[model samples]
Target chain A: MKISELSECSGVSIASIKFYQREELLPEPERTSPNQAQYDTQHVDRLRLIRALVDVGGLSVATVRTVLAAAESDIPMDWAMGVAQRAIPGSVELPATTTRGVSEIDTITETLGWKVSPDNPGRGMAARVIDSYVQLDHEEILSVLPEYSRAAMIVAAADLASVGLQPSRMRMSETVVVGTVLGDSLFAGLRRMAQEDEARRRYAQVQS
Target chain B: MKISELSECSGVSIASIKFYQREELLPEPERTSPNQAQYDTQHVDRLRLIRALVDVGGLSVATVRTVLAAAESDIPMDWAMGVAQRAIPGSVELPATTTRGVSEIDTITETLGWKVSPDNPGRGMAARVIDSYVQLDHEEILSVLPEYSRAAMIVAAADLASVGLQPSRMRMSETVVVGTVLGDSLFAGLRRMAQEDEARRRYAQVQS
Candidate 1:
């Protein structure tokens, strides 16, 4: 298929396809002539994945490139998952002043009996939230950490189960990356709705 | 405290404090002179909240203004929460082509016995994710919606409980808004860690 057809089929623009190619996020197509190149269903699929990462996951182009490279690599699924998670925006090192928050997260992970690596970017990211709570003097909010951890374990199990349902290792890898990214958005959205429902149940006055 | 003292206390730069004032994100301080203004503890607290919304919540200055206004208003906490959630990015109305996806989300909410409003931006956001799955031919991923919904309920309960712990209605309103925003980041970070642990448990080989 031509680039235009790729754009039409994949719902990506031609210019973005070219930009992605230049960024090495998309591989070069087979040249049919001096001025023409052909794309395949794989290109379409890749484009869709890129769009999901960018649009839904809200990843930067650089981060999207990182995720795509990890997804395409022949590494173990867990390692690839780690790469994808680390590539996310907030998964950076925290300041030294956040030791208390980091320790609190360590306690939560330990209490959950989950063997998360000490260096998992998620640890830092979660600790950063804890640090924010501490900074705002809202330490009472930390009381809900256990519940959040339990719910996260449940959701992570579901996430892995969903990935397991994919038919191929390649598909599973793609699912792991896409699911890790989009799953956050999905859960966050559902959570807002659920929060509203819970609030209504607890606080809404019954209509006379 | 002067504006510089406010900056020193909040750790926000002098320029950013002025910018927030210009953006109306921060209220004008009591002018001590033609070029000097006095800030207070309230100013410091508001600055912290603004930073949390902008930095951790990744909300725009416009959205931060919306959330601050909602939090400060003499409205019910749940209503304030609605405003905050709606102001977040990706909470906008989805395109009309997403009816199928929206209905799928409706079914999930109904299954959960959650009375979410049809206009809830979360419903639209989650439906957009569903549409992405459909477009990518990854409907198998939807199998986990029930689990995701269950997990969301658990987390939402925690979120509301945390809000309930606040000592004042004003604090509760702030927590409701701040929690709704940062809770997503908090949960996403923890979910990544939990996913890693689960991946290790399911896939890690026995090290000799």
Candidate 2:
């Protein structure tokens, strides 16, 4: 396929594809002639993955570049996943950096006996969420943390298992990178649908 | 309190606070005299909410403005929540307008008896996610939708319960708006932490 076909297939503009090439996000194509380049299935796959990460996953270009590098490398799946996960943006700041919040997350993780690295951004991200709830004087919302974590565990188990089932190393790598990013949105959307269902079930009786 | 004190307390820059005020994201502070405006605890609270929605929720200024308006309105909690949830961005694009994807989502929601409106962005968002996985030829990933929806129901049950526990109409409305927005990030962050834990547990013995 030519670059035009790749652009058409991926729904990415030709200029943007060229820009991704300039940014080293996409690999150089094979030159069939002095003025023509030929792309293959792999190029189309990579472009789609990049579009998912940038457009849907809302990852920054630099972050997308790092993720692409990880996807292409022959690194272990777990290692590649770690790199991709770390590149994700974390939460913004809050007033009074609360040691209490950190300690609370520590308690939950310890109680669950889940061996996560001390440096995982999820730790800080979760803590910041707690802080946000606290700042709003809505600390009662944190009571749902245990339930949320349990749901997370279930979803995570499925996610991890899906990555393991991929047929190829490249597929596995793509799943780890693109899957982890877009999975957030996927679950979020589903969660909202489920929430609406549950809300109507519980409240429809009372409201009527 | 003075604007400077509000800025210091909220950790928002004076200019940004002024910007929010102009944007009607924050209600105008009472003018003490021609040269000065006096802010109170309400200003601080609203500022923190604005920051949470903008910084953590990743909402646009325009979306945040609508959300703030919802928070101030005497509308029902569910109505306010609907506004906030609808304002959230969804997936970018997918190949071929698949009526199949829409019907698939409709089937799932119908089976669950979830009374989601036709216009809910979650409906399309969820469909687009499925489409992305299909485009990548990883439709197997969609197999977990049932599990994900189950988890979402549990979380949503807790979320609605929490809103019901709020002490005032204003607080409930605020939670409906702000919670619906930031809750996505809150859950995403927690899901990552939970995922790390689960992955380590499942794969640790294999690797180590």
Candidate 3:
């Protein structure tokens, strides 16, 4: 197949495909002639994965590059998934001096008996939420942390189980990255629906 | 206090506060002179909310404006939060003719007895994840939907309970908006940590 076919099949623009190639998100294809290059099934699959990361997963190109490299590495699936999870774009930066929020989050993780790295961006990311809540004088919001973590554990277990069912290492890595990134939106979307359900049930008596 | 003071107290940059002001994300402070405007505690609080939405919640200024307006409305908290959820940036646009994903999502929502509005962006957002998965020939990934939805219900219940703890209508509205936005990242971050723990446990045999 050619670039145009790849574009048509993947539904990604040629310019984006070129941009991805330049950004090293996609690999260079074989040149069939001075002006033509031939792409293969791998290119199609790679482009689809790239689109899934950027479009659905909302990962930055650099992060996607790093994730792709990790996927291609000989590292264990667990480590590859961890790398991809850390590379997620978390814009909420915590001040290095704020030990309280971090410690509070660690307490929840420890009580849950979950052993994650001290440097997992997830910890800092979760801590940022607590910090925001505290900043607003709504520290009581932390009361919900345990429940959220329990629910998170359930979802995470199911996520890993799904990844475990994949047929190949490459597919597992792709699922890990996509599931981590887009799964947020998926679960958030479901949460909205669930909230609507719960809110309706709670308000029915008031309305009645 | 002035804009500078509000910025100083909130730790948000003056330029961003100005940008939010210009974007109508924040209401105008009272002008005491031709060149000087005085802000108050409300300004500080509002600035923090704006920063939380933009920085941590990853909402667009336009969406923030809509959400702020929703927050100020006399509408029920449920409706206001719905508006905010619908205004979130879901960049993965599906073709207008694409009904398969929407109906597939509807099936899940129906099965769960959720009563969300047809136009709820959460529906579309989650549908986009499904569409991406199907596009990549990983439809089996939907196997995790039930688990994710079940977990989402737990978190949503906690989320609403936290909001119910608020003391005033205004504070309730604020919590609704903040929780809806920041809560996504918070859960996602925790999910990552939870995933690490679960993966560690599952892969322990391989590592050992």
Worst 10 residues of 1 chain A by lDDT: A83-92
Which candidate wins on TM-score? Answer: 1
lDDT of each: 0.80, 0.74, 0.80
lDDT per residue for candidate 3 within B23-63, as digits (tens), equals: 77777989999899998888887777676667656787877
In order of appearance, the predictions have TM-scores of 0.79, 0.75, 0.77
Model 1 misplaced stretches (Cα beyond 4 Å): A1-75, A87-90, A96-98, B1-77
For candidate 2, what is the lDDT? 0.74
DockQ of each: 0.55, 0.43, 0.54
Residues A110-161 of candidate 3: C-alpha lDDT, one tens digit per residue: 8989888877778888888778788767787788899999999999989999
Rank all candidate structures by their DockQ, best first, as comma-separated numbers.
1, 3, 2
Residue pairs with backbone overlap in model 1? none
In model 2, how many backbone clashes occur?
Answer: 0
Please tell me how candidate 3 rates in CAPRI terms: medium
Pick by DockQ: 1 or 2, better one: 1
- Candidate closer to the true structure by DockQ (higher is better), 1 or 3: 1
